[model samples]
Target: MSGRAENMIQLIDVSKEYKMADSCRVALQHINLTISEGEYIGILGLNQSGKSTLARLLNGLLKPTTGQVLINGMATDSPQEIRQIRQLLGMVFQNPDNQLICPVVEEEIAFGPENLGLPPEEVNKRVDWALELVGMQEMRYHAPHLLSGGQKQKVALASVLAMQPRYLVLDEPTSMLDPLSRREILEHLCRINQENHITIILISHHPEDLLDAKRLILLHEGSIYMQGTPKEVFKDMEKLKAIGLKRPGLYQLIQQVEEEGYRIDDNIKTIPQLVEMICRI
Candidate 1:
């Protein structure tokens, strides 16, 4: 798919600083960005980088120390603006346990719309649609505690979807999940973005997490390191390694093309895609 959509988020020269006991910490600097609706985006960085800080800024959880953060053309700091923007932007944190407060699946999904004082019928309709969208319809009555990590994440996704948010911000949603659960969550996110027309802004360290995103934005200390398609970002293997990121194992095969001195287009991004590309060559 083309890496373009309706512009849903815009951060104009945004900066953030936090005051500590003796000193101030600079979390981010002059970061400007725009997110389009239905576009799958990944933010990659090492631990303690400004990835989470940016996520918070998106939903107005933290105000920028300088510059402006705009959502759907309105500045985020205005109380009236934020209240309206927040309804269109929903966030999911690293742990599903923290986000899931209700005991049952249906109630959790209905919580957001219910708070808006939506009619009971409308709320129920949204809950049912969100549950089925995340493939959790069968488990609607199941207790949240009984769900596996992957299932819980799906329910978390359902909760966000239930709010009918146009944009979804996930701050390392799969960080605590097992490999299987991680894949499951990632797959659901891909399907959600594609089928539901929901914009996705994800922050993660895992390269696998970038698989479904059309573009990857690398953040260091508090700056944009690079931004491009996954294949474009992975092309510079040494640059990625220098920044504490690694390309997939298939990247080794791609590098071999240079060793053999061939000018072939080895822009394959995924292992399966790489295998097929090589076989076709």
Candidate 2:
């Protein structure tokens, strides 16, 4: 945890509710959180646990019913500051099909910068840079619809990266992809966080996806159920199961090996680590 880092996003006593003719449903309840700049934070929850709602609030796509959401010290509720807030924070959704607007990949990547009224030369530069960043430079002129699921997702991510946002909020960006694609997207995001110093707020249901995050936040029934380092949070199997979540496959395997009288270290998170530990035994 980087305690010395400054806060980039803050939620203070925030709550969100949707009103219906018959009843009002609360999506979030009195939540308070602070996300520092350059931090990789993963949000974990089951469906309808307010994960998507929280992402929208962070980027000002949805307003909080109560309290406040502040991005870089600017209030999300302020209409005048909304544009600036959005420019500083980029959001990618679960469906790449919905996010891909332009027919061509390069055009889609340039859309955000073009909207900002950047010069043509600047827009072209950004498009090229974003394509390279996502390892999609060869697909620049390709049609988005003709690409694979992972490629489309990479194009969508390139579009967001083109804007050069200081913070990126992803809501289940890998949910619709194949297993290999999911791993590729996660690896790219990890690189973006480490090399670019961009703050990442990733919402995911996969236990393995949360392992690399500096902090993991678990939401249950519209409230924060747990918050801690990945190891600290996932080690509590009983609590996670009660909240409808599961431990990572690696963790479960390690536990089973320990039960078989093998002195495996409980903290091993990767296959290489496990193999190295077993060799020492």
Candidate 3:
């Protein structure tokens, strides 16, 4: 996270509830958070932990039942400002099928910018740029529905990237992907955050999916349970297990080794770092 970057998203005492036939279900309860520009944040939780609800709140897909959500200081509850808010914030959901609507890949990627009424030349530039960013330039003319699952997800991502949003929010974007594809998507997110300086708010239940995040916010039931960097938050293994979240296997192994008095450098995060630590020992 950059110290000088301004706050791009803020949830001030936010809560959301859904009305059923006879009763109401509280999906979120008083979530107060701030995400600064150029930060990669992970929202971790099990099912029914308000992860999806929070994601929707950020971009004004759903208004808060109580409190407020602000994007770059613009209130989401304000309909007049919502269009601009959404333009500044882009969301990528779990299923690519829900987002991909165009017949061709380039057309799908150009949808958002085109709707913004950009000139043909500018739209074409964005379409080409987004496709290249996601490595989908080769498939620009291909039909979106016929692509493989991973490819479809990439196309979906390219579509959002074409909008060139300042903040990107992903809700379980890799849940439907295979292991290799999931890894690829996560790597793409990390690269986007670092190279483009776009703020990334990734929601997932998998700890491994969030390893690249600069900070982790753990949600339980309908409120925030804990928040910190990956090392700080995942250190409480028993607490995470109690909340129905699993730590990555490598993280578990490293924790156990450290428990036995082995000195593992705090800077060591990935497998390569762990291997180097072991070699030195």
Q: Find the candidate with the highest TM-score and give its number.
A: 3
TM-score of each prediction: 0.92, 0.92, 0.95
**What lDDT would each prediction earn against the true structure?**
0.85, 0.89, 0.90
- Write the residue-wise lDDT of candidate 2 on 1-281 in tens digits: 22222347889899999899999999999999999889999999999999999999998989999998888888899999899999999999999999998889999998999999999999999998889878999999999999999999999999999999999999999999998999889989989999999999999988787777989999999999999988678768899989778888777767667777986654566778987887888
Q: Return the clash pairs for model 3, or none.
A: none
Q: Model 1 segments beyond 4 Å from truth?
A: 1-6, 257-269
Q: Where does candidate 1 have its weakest 10-residue lDDT segment?
A: 1-10
Candidate 3 regions exceeding 4 Å error are 1-6, 260-267
Per-residue C-alpha lDDT of model 3 across residues 1-281, encoded as one tens digit per residue: 22222456888899999999999999999999989989999999999999999999999989999997888888898989999988999999999999999999988998999999999999999998888878888999999999988999999998999999999999999999999999988888989999999999999988889988989999999999999988888888888878778888768778887888897776676888888888888
Better by TM-score, candidate 3 or 1: 3
- Name the TM-score of candidate 1: 0.92
Model 3 — which ten-residue stretch has the worst lDDT? 1-10
